[model samples]
Target chain A: MAVAESPPSDPEAPPKVRVGRTPGRLGNRVFQGISTASGIFILIILAAVAIFLLVRAWPALIAAPSAFEDVGFMLGRDLWSWVWPLLFGTAISSVIALVVAVPLSIGIGLFISHYAPRRLAQGLGYLIDLLAAIPSVIFGLWGIQWLQPLVSPLFTWLSTNGATAWLEENVGPTIFTGYQAPARNILTAGLVLAIMILPIITATVREVFLQTPRLHEEASLALGATRWEMIRQAVLPFGRSGVISATMLGLGRALGETMAVLMVLSPGYLINFYLLQPGQHQSIAANIASHFPEASGLGVDALIASGLILFIMTFGVNLIARWIISRRAEFSGAN
Target chain B: MSKRIDVNDLNVYYGDFLAVEGIDMVIEARSVTALIGPSGCGKSTFLRTLNRMHEVIPKAYVTGKAVMDGQDLYGPGVDPVEVRRQVGMVFQRPNPFPTMSIADNVLAGVRLNNRRISKSDAADLVERSLTGANLWNEVKDRLNLPGSSLSGGQQQRLCIARAIAVEPQVLLMDEPCSALDPISTLAIEELISELKNDYTIVIVTHNMQQAARVSDRTGFFNIAGTGKPGHLIEMDDTTTMFSTPSEKSTEDYISGRFG
Candidate 1:
């Protein structure tokens, strides 16, 4: 065999060769550095959005110096009073959706992961993925055109039969059999939002349920526990933290949910006691989307300011969720 | 305190492929039976079949009878869950429920079966089980600690305590000491010997010395060739199996000539 090749060198000069050879390990270090750069890129995008929202909404911020002056506080009492009503409407409708959606979301998640067979579960899971992919505007159109008619009577039943007893006394309206239906009400809009956010919550929770360690299930079942008992003792305990995280994620989605709330809520300008009574019940997101096009100078700023609030609310929720899961990393990492 | 098992002409399969073939064996009451085999030999599969734990896999199954305490364990109406309850299992690596404390781990079986007891009774059961597994003295002061906090030996012993807490008639151990250090392995072997006084113990072990040290009887499993199903080669008293004559195949296996 030929001796290992080397470049021809001058015999008179001392041989000079490569120093500090990296032992072929530098390639792995380079690959790791490349991945770190991509990870940092994601962080950069998030920081940029936060900073941009802050800058754009600075003029209309609640804490802005210009937000002061009893002049505006008095005005807040008067015509410019759309803020509280909208805030109230947003809070009320989102709360309504939370009540209806959170449990249903978790139930759907568990059923898909545990109760359904492989093909049916996969098909259903794919349908949920499809729902998440649909835009909020398309959801809005579908809600108004298709869903409302189907849901209106159920709303009527809930409003009348042993339902809304609180509504009668609280709203200063006397009880009547079939008086008036706030068909385009917060109740209507909330139901729409619930349907929209269901897929999000279900996806998060299903991922969590599926991520539960297989050893845990085997260990539980080997104890001679019935399936339900195993789920309750082993699956549920391990899943509690994941459920909370999923709920937070769903809550954030609901708080910022827009077009469906806009198209269905029958926008109002008053923060009334009767949610179904249909006064000026406009959610913050709905309010902005509806009015931002019409607002002039500071009004546009004010809407951006409201957008800022929405952005912050959503951001804060996500931040708290990330913080929580870091402390208790129990949620399915894929979610 | 012991219960017998009759695994008759059992064939284990995953989906369509056979894993073990024609395993006919009877495990005596209150005695230790060791299954020794080479890699890919189906000793672990046979051990899992005893407790019906093979059902966990989607298509894994047994085609013959495994009668526990004279009840046809694979009868049409026999519940696998109930079989597992009566015949408990300890896996290769100690698997105490991570969410539970040491005491809770021991009580897990009873709790899962919804067998209620007073708090005082539960504490007594915990102490008794730990003492039974020779783990009480090491763990008595810290039963509230997470089950995973114990050293490997203590964890395996805690698992033994957990398995015995249900008062199982049979315990199926699948290479239970394979993941342990020599010291832990020794501890487990000693525990198995004492354990056999109450529970019928079937252990699948790669270590022939361990099989010799702990078992009353030994069954040697060997494969025919690559991708061929495993079958029992020989079964006899551990002493004769180790010291005296047997089939050429059995002698070859015991003598480490071939497996």
Candidate 2:
């Protein structure tokens, strides 16, 4: 079995075995080509969408201010001025969604992954997955009909209560002072988005928490650490990046969510800090859906331009998430 | 601070299945005791029962008495956490906290207990514990680096430092060097001998040579069949166990016959 021995010079000697070369099989080449083509197709589709958005939005980018008269908010204002408030609305609502969803997601994730009994964990996991599968339109209907009325009294209390008067007078005159009836405000939209993204973030966080190296957990426990202490030492740190990435994904969904915000938020075009006020905020996706039917000429292009802005923001958020995930890879202990 | 352990009629089980049955033995203080057996013989399960670490697995429980210093470890009022604080364990793999710095990892056992030490005292403890594990000289310059930055052997030593930081009375190592290279295994064996001066140590090893090299006393475990529970075949001084074991099965196993 000498691999490197020279081949015999005899005419009857058998062919020497070649160890390194793989036979060129048709099936292998076909499979490799299909997978490579599929990967490139995704990038091509992404680029094509970007190109389409830019081409469709070019007319509004250079249109005269007078051309926007049909769209009441952009009558005399340039595109940037009209879009800035929408951009603010998008950011504020999504930030609220993130701030609310992250802590709750971590709690629920840990409960399912570590705290729940074996039978209960499986049942709760399925329930959360079902929540994620519920349609956005159904959530929109539930938000407008159910959640809006339920939360109106709390907003009214904050606006008119004696205990909150000081907060309105000294701290947030614009933010907490104004309260409109029916509770169809940006804050309500944010709350609905929070509910929408809860299951998504919880699923990711729970999966990462469950995947924590059991040895690290035992190491903590062997040090006489309590259950909470063991989670603090081993579970939380390991799932930190996972939580951030999950938050970013939720942010992306919130930024582009149309039905819930459109149905829950009363439309307005203004840059203000009045979170509870009905006629003070409007998100870009909601704005486009509401105006697209009545828009004409450059008005349509203007809405698309606004969509381009939202597209860039979500893309940027995803890029940041990827960077954070890769940066933490070195010490993730998963190696 | 080292303490002896005495066990009687210990039976380990996972749910309805018994894993290790009818074990009775005494482990002397300030000495190394090695348990050698083939895979699935439940030697590691028996080791975990000493500190109640077996109960960490859902439905895995132990029945019997493991007494140390006139206290039954499995007594009704005793906390498993308190037992683990006295009896520390090292797993087969080296697992350092990935997010912690080298200095922080060395202090993990103390810090995780919610103990507050002053800055100077914390620094002194880190240096002393790392030195005790023979890792201070190699890592003193980069205390701020992550624990995973070290080589595998260094990380294992760092785990040893983390364990000893709490000043446990007994150390249980379950095949601590099975994943390591020969030189690393030698270093761990030498460290084990030095460590016996401060802590009662019980180690489960698949390698009989490792048992012969480091242990003062040895126990051989064997299983009757695939589904039957494992039991201790024989226990004696390491020299006698390797040279003139009383059980026929122990001799056959040691002589590389059927295990």
Candidate 1 per-residue C-alpha lDDT over B1-259 given as tens digits, one digit per residue, 9 for 90 to 100: 6799888999999999899999999899999999998889888887888888888787898898888777888899888888888988888877777667889999999887567899999999999999999999998898887787788788888888989999989998988898899999898898998998888999999889998999999998989888899999889989988888477887887789975
Q: Write the per-residue lDDT of candidate 2 for residues B29-115, one digit (tens) a residue.
A: 999999998899999999999999988999998889999998999999999999999999888999999888899998888986678
**Model 1 chain B worst lDDT run, 10 consecutive residues:** B91-100
Kindly give the stretch of ten consecutive residues in candidate 2 chain B with the minimal lDDT sum: B106-115
- On TM-score, the candidate that comes out on top is 2
lDDT of 2 by residue, A208-310 (tens): 8998989889999988888999999999998888888888878888999999999999977899888899988889998898889888778889999999999
lDDT of 2 at A193: 95
What TM-score does model 2 achieve against the real structure? 0.94
lDDT of model 2 at position B59: 96
Task: Return the top candidate by lDDT.
Answer: 2
Q: Please provide TM-scores computed only on chain A for all of the candidate models, following their numbering.
A: 0.77, 0.91
